[model samples]
Target: MEGLLTAETLYLALGMLACGAVAGVLAGLLGVGGGIVIVPVLYTTLGFLNIDPDIQMHIAVGTSLATIIPTSISSSRAHHKRGAVDFSLIKIWAISIVIGAIIGIAVAGQVKSPTLTAVFAVIALIVALNMLTNPNGKAIWQSLPDKLVAQPIAAAVGGFSVLMGIGGGTLSVPILTLFNFPIHRAVGTAALFGLLISLPGTIGFIYNGWGHPSLPAASLGYVNLIGLALISPVTMLFAPLGAKIAHSISKKALRIAFGIFLLLTSIRMFSGKLF
Candidate 1:
């Protein structure tokens, strides 16, 4: 085991620490689980370790979902403390989101890396478009839709979030704002949904990838414990700082900036250069 810590590995570990720091701030500031950043980094990390190409995306997604647990907890707690959370919406959306996440986990296990990569790219494209086209966040309706419509929407958010290894904020925050909810409240509630999605996503990925031979060291199934250990605490520490930033400034600029990032990410994914 001592032999495992090569110079390259040490450099990778430092990169993950930086990734976690950035992810934590994003999680709190944007209500995302930082899975967007974490997934790609973990994917690259696992590939760098010479894990099988076939399963690398799965492991990345699973590990990213695992990391989201702490990120969501820290971000959500910060939001809750600030009275930004709306439990009523959380209560309404919870079950559907869990169901979608379960289905996503099952499907992820059955698919190959290319498919998963495409899913991420497509989802990222959609999110990027949303952010770019509607950064100002105009409401589509004066109020949220009733349960029948709302549940399906929530399910989509959860399912896509799991597929992309993202927290619900990537989808949920925009949807909430479109339904006329305040952005801060939308971000807070999305943080809770991140928890809902990650809990099931982590377990399902673990079960799905259990005993896979190509997984890296310290892996519990596809969730790499090393990555988790290295990333989670750092994210927790910085998430509150993001929350503080979110409360202090308008997100329109950040929204546009992130949209550009997502756009580049989507284009990169679609170009097949990374895969």
Candidate 2:
């Protein structure tokens, strides 16, 4: 480990720290897995290190999902303390979500890195647009489907979120709110879903990426322990603070700011492949 600390490694470490910090805040603030922030940044960082192109995005996705495990637990506990979590919803959706996540992991392993990047970009753009136009959940469909209808949607949410290395809140929150679930409860429940998604997702990535060649140092399959080492603690530290702030502040401005950020991030993801 000591011998690996060249200038490049130092720079990467610093970058990971920043990514972890940002992800923590977002996880708390948005009840997300922070994969939306971490994936693109990791892609950039690994690109700089000139790692194997074939595995770079896989590493990013795996690491992001792995970090989400602890981050989601922390954020979910905070929200649960405040009575924001709806355990019934979690109970209702749990099995389906897990099954969908397994399917997503299987599919991700078969897809190319560029295809994954494109999928992330598309999803990010949709999320940004939703946040920008419906910051308060007032713009689009305002009701959730019946359980018979919801089961399939829930599965899709889990599958897509796992594929994108996210916590599922990006899709879950909106779906819940449309069904008239309170926003806070939706956010908290989504945090739990992040845990569900990340655990199986991370395991799947590790299994899928096992024995892949030229993985970066400290990688366990596609999951980079070094990245988790740099990121997890910081993210856990900051998540409660973000949750506290979310409760106290007006989120409209924050939503707008985050929307712009997501837009730019999406553009970067899309353009990276092009150039």
Candidate 3:
């Protein structure tokens, strides 16, 4: 407990709590899996703490995954209560996601941090642009061959989720909506998909970072156990509050705001300075 009281520790904890609150609200409202919010925040915070620049992205992704475990559960449950989840889709996508996550983590371990951050930045920019352009969350494709279509998309989602430390909701919701699924249902189902992606993604980071001496104290491989523990519960507690707000907001307004926020966050991350 005394260790948790230093100025640095107190600031980190408070900062994490604030990030968790914003992330929880966003997760509930946007079905975004909160990684967009969490990743940049963690990265910036770690940067401030003078962690190795080379490992910044790894820490960002790992810490985000840890936070998502609880955030996803809370947001998913809220959406579930509103009858939003498409369990059938989850069943179809789960296996491929697990496989992809394993591969993604392995790949992440071998890659340089600059490359990882660059790739994540590109993806985040694309997602943000897509959201801005498609506020209605409409589908581009009405239908497709189930096995062929579902498998590839699921794999892609898993791979990206692990690489970017996102919950897959950013990609998943758009794809599902493009397939003509209603926005609410797509959001709901995407939330569940996040669980599948995060579980294996987190494990992959753990395995990938195993025995790395530079890893901070209280870390499990790439995963920051302390950061996760500090953020998860508060995120869970505030998620339902976000859901209630989401229900009241206009979809277009929400999409625009979130899109802008993502763009700003991406830019900040690319700048490589802690704010």
Better of 2 and 3 by lDDT: 2
Better of 1 and 2 by TM-score: 1
Q: Write the per-residue lDDT of candidate 1 for residues 103-142, one digit (tens) a residue.
A: 8988898899989999999988988899889988778898
Candidate 1 residue spans exceeding 4 A from truth: 1-5, 272-275
What candidate 3 gets wrong by more than 4 Å, as runs, is: 1-5
Sort by lDDT, best first: 1, 2, 3
Give the best candidate by lDDT: 1
Among residues 3 or more apart in sequence or in different chains, the pairs in candidate 3 whose N, CA or C atoms overlap within 3 Å are 139-178, 140-178
User: How many clashes in each structure?
Assistant: 0, 4, 2
Cα lDDT, all candidates: 0.88, 0.84, 0.81
For model 2 the local lDDT of residue 77 reads 95
Clashing pairs in 1: none
- Leading candidate by TM-score: 1
Candidate 2 has an lDDT of: 0.84
lDDT of model 1 at residue 176? 84
